[model samples]
Target chain A: MLPAHLRMLARLGNGEVTMQVDGPVTQRSILDALEAQYPMLRGTIRDHVTKQRRPFVRFFACEEDLSHEPPDAPLPEAVLSGTEPFMIVGAMAGG
Target chain B: MPGVRVLVGTRKGAFVLTSDSGRKQWEVSGPHFAGWEIYHMKGSPVAPNRLYVSQSSGWFGQLIQRSDDGGATWEPVGNAFVYDGVPGTHQWYDGTQHPWEFKRVWHIEPSLTDPDVVYAGAEDAALFRSDDGGLTWQELSGLRRHTTGPSWQPGAGGMCLHTIKLDASDPNRIFVAISAAGAFRTEDGGETWRPINRGLRSQGIPDEDAEVGHCVHSIAMHPARPDVLFMQKHWDVMRSDNAGELWHEVSGNLPSDFGFPIAVHAHEPNTVYVVPIKSDSEHFPPEGKLRVYRSRTGGDEWEALTTGLPQQDCYVNVLRDAMAVDSLDSCGIYFVTTGGQVYASPDGGDTWSAIVRDLPAVLSVEVQTLP
Candidate 1:
């Protein structure tokens, strides 16, 4: 299952988990595909102009926090092979 | 007219409160686009069903919501607001140069006769026009490119184009006011502009009657008399009879002239409305009494209308865009306060009732008198 931040796309998508990897399967490609389909989530995950990950949003997969990793970098074999779903998380702070 | 629909924009979301011609029994349907800052929502004067809503968030930026069938259902429109050409800088809070940024829309003025043509006023103080409905927008940069753009600064609120007044008689004439930057008029459509603040005296600025640095809170132009404009400045209510060419202070009998939101009656050209807050520092009704002052002969004489409002222990501030007037036969008045209250007066301003209570802080209120 994905984290709570990526789950907001379920309200607009066709109810599928969108686990299919078409080409290269990079983090940027997946988010671009998701934001391409659901325009409402455009700026929530990343800066609309800077294209940087939002300060509060993070990327996680295969028991590793990939938030600071490069967007075009490849993922672990578990995530690449669909054994684990890419997770978009809202980081906790200030509490 | 069949009924009235109040398109209310709040800090969280948008709301639609409808009532029959009586303006008594209302059915509230909202918070549409929940968990977003709805700065403004308005219906087209030509097509009442064509509604436009401005929704934004710090995370998601700005989005325009349009509903062809009134406020029943909505679809998201374009959110991108790109400044035209060289996108220069304005005076920042520290008296430094700050690049213009696209922020939430402050006002939406749809065309008088076209549902597809609408205008949006945005923060960073610029005007935008959408010709193909709201699906796309282009900046009318002449106003921002006026010679005095460098001297313009933001009010306590960001530098925002908060008011847009289009002349019904002359389609070419357009008037827009920005906080801390005074008022401007465009005679040849949107191609050229000039400051029309000749007699405004803002003590906060170095030159009290400077040409371009007055914080105009709100400006209202009666539809019948488009040339006559009424303004609620940072401290006083002013009037300009010759289409903003020259101005005079008409705040003779107001309790306190420091407040936001100035509205005009639907039928009475000489009748106007303003809620008198205590002072600039204290942004609430005087003596804890929420009174709406009405001037029958424009601005000198004032009478407080306080039959159905809170008398004491109430402190709700009214924002500049939170008041509106309907054009029914008897005329209807509506306003929402920062304390989460929406007050309505069906008989003009005689009596008031809280049609809505305990919502998020209201940002703007606009009414559509339907046939």
Candidate 2:
């Protein structure tokens, strides 16, 4: 079990969805929880085999772009402490 | 034949080019969608008069404009496909919250089997399909719906779907390349897709499975032999004969392996073409030389074609969709670089000539024969 007030930002199709997560989450745990909640989000975040980040999905916490951070890397203390929001943004471009 | 019509899509607008007798004289048309950025312009193969342009207006939103009168006038597909977001929800992508928000449509390809069916690859790593020409669209969420765990992270370009290749022989069999996810294939149309990144190479993975994150920029299939495919990967050029089941690097002979576009001669399936560029460190044409290489033996041997190109230092970046080979018997190979120059090789890349220069950054070029 985790804290009840931790918020997450899941960006999709040029829009962001901020949802509440109840746990101490690493990149892997956050995505696992997301997939369990929204089954449609299964393969949307990482590579199927290597479990590495896809080119388009970016994660951020407290103004920091955590996209390239390690999968199991610990989230910011503020994000874990339920004091700040973690954002997942979609990076869109025409070219 | 009157001449070849070149549809040029740019960062700003769309342009049309009509040539005279010897392919010497060219009349260039409008920067249609003037202030907007046109990422893709696809002329309907089934209907010569129909043209589709995908544009993104900074702070104005993204749109798919259709032109029935060639490149003269345009109209949007309506409000149905607009990104409105959930009602009353002040989400980040909420159009009402961020009034100027829109997703960029990076690539668009009309269905070979169904002319009205059009598919678009977006920056969000999602696929949108339009059944009635370019009127309305529906997101194919299946590609984003199957990841079971957390390892699925988006790469540098975001989780984007850059290229979509549908089999002309079997429209149901489709292939899509994601920037970091490698390549995916689907036999049952868009109902389901499977990652086919077995033999490619990526940056983060171990040497044994480096093929996973190879960052596939573009892929070309031998029209006659669908199983034979060529990929312009981030670090190397590779070929897969078993329809991506396995891949082997064939970029040894080229001066550099870092490039974006790859095209196979329409008539001669064994023949393919690639514009090589210096690696990430240099990131330019090899030794300041602008050349196109043709591999007639399926990457076994390559010949540099520079008949009428600049003889001196030439440093230009040719985008993936900027270079294409026509489907004619003799075949016409064309390429546009970031330097606003267009080159055409009518002799199957054996000889080259400049078609036009001093235009906007050439994002994409498609050649169509006019009746």
Candidate 3:
């Protein structure tokens, strides 16, 4: 799942997008695959140079906040197994 | 019939306003990129149908959008703005050295003769150029690497290179202005730059007459006479007679000299426009009157244009990039205010009317006179 704005930018019709990761399902691998599939989303979710998640962006999988997890850490088994969708969220700030 | 298309960048999104040569009725189509902040959008002079936009957000970062068929459709282009070599540091607000970081694009200037070449002025005070339209960008590091770079500090706003003026007469020359850093001129394209702030004086800085410490709010030049330039500094309205080699005060007879945007008449190089605010501390108009000061003699003497403009209880401010001029026979002038009103003066500055009464506090406005 992606934020409405990012989904609109990437021209995704559905809120949730499924991508094929070549290797183990980690945050870095999923993000790398996402960027490769949607070039327009580059630097939107993470910094181009630092690859750090933007301050106002969060990641969630299996109903748990995974934004603070290491980029290379493995995602939840539910997310890897496609039972649960990985979510990229725009934080609840700004009126 | 010839027509005009007004590109408006506001706090929330961008709006494109079109009107026939009569300049009476307008068709407003907008709120594109609905939730993002559109800093600036401008059409190319050579190819009026081609447009470039700086769409950014605090959460998602910067993105460049280009339109090949006017404002009908847009595609995201290059957003990466990596500085050249080792990005150095500049003086922060507290006088401590702060490392340079890419913030956002504040302005975009398309090539005068080519639709694909463009320039972007960015926050943290850097210039980037793209030759293949907006797909790729490369920093023109000469301006930020000046000898006085370390001493350059941000104004109340972050250190933003918010103005870029291309000389139509001489492609080799380009001018850019940064708040609290004064103005600079580049004669050898963007490879090298020199401070062109000779006669400017800013009391806020340690040296009132330093070469590169004056806070230049905005700068304007008439393409027919590129050597002559006009500036709206933090506190004074100024004019440069010889391509910014030197400048002098032209704030005579105005109720207040402090202003934001400055623009020149499309046909009359001698006519200039400025919207004076009360002071740097208070950005509203003087006496709650939203009037545009016009100087027919190129400055030193100004007249208050208030017909159709609010004269009482108005406190909205005009931003540095919110005023622009069109080259139609009547020479239309347009400006947007923080109160979310976009005003148009179809016949010079003699009269005015609001194109749109309510917008999201316009950030910038650009006009294209189409054939």
* Candidate number of the best lDDT: 3
Is 1 or 2 the stronger prediction by DockQ?
1
How do the residues B1-371 of candidate 2 rate in per-residue lDDT, one tens digit apiece? 64577888776677887674356677889777665667778877777667787776443345677777777776565213322232121112222322212247878887765667889887655677899987667767666554511234345555457788888788788888876657878888887887777777665566657433447888999667989889998778899998788888888688778788899987888888999988775656887889888899889588888888775788778887887776555678888887878888777888888777777787888777666
Per-prediction DockQ, in order? 0.32, 0.02, 0.86
Report the candidate with higher DockQ, 1 versus 3.
3
User: Residue A15's C-alpha lDDT in candidate 2?
Assistant: 44
Model 3 residue B116 CA deviation in Å: 0.4
- Backbone clashes, candidate 3: 0
Question: What's model 3's lDDT at B214?
Answer: 88
The true-versus-predicted C-alpha distance at residue B329 of model 1, in Å, is 0.7
Interface RMSD after interface superposition, model 1: 3.2
Q: Arrange candidates by DockQ, highest first: which order?
A: 3, 1, 2
Tell me the tens digit of each residue's lDDT in model 1 across B186-255. Answer: 9987889999998888887777668898999999989999989999999989999999998899998888
At residue A10, give the lDDT of candidate 2: 21
Models sorted by TM-score, best on top: 3, 1, 2
What's model 3's lDDT at B366? 99
Which segments of model 1 are wrong by more than 4 Å?
A1-10, A13-23, A43-70, A75-78, A89-95
Interface RMSD of every predicted model, in angstroms: 3.2, 11.0, 0.5
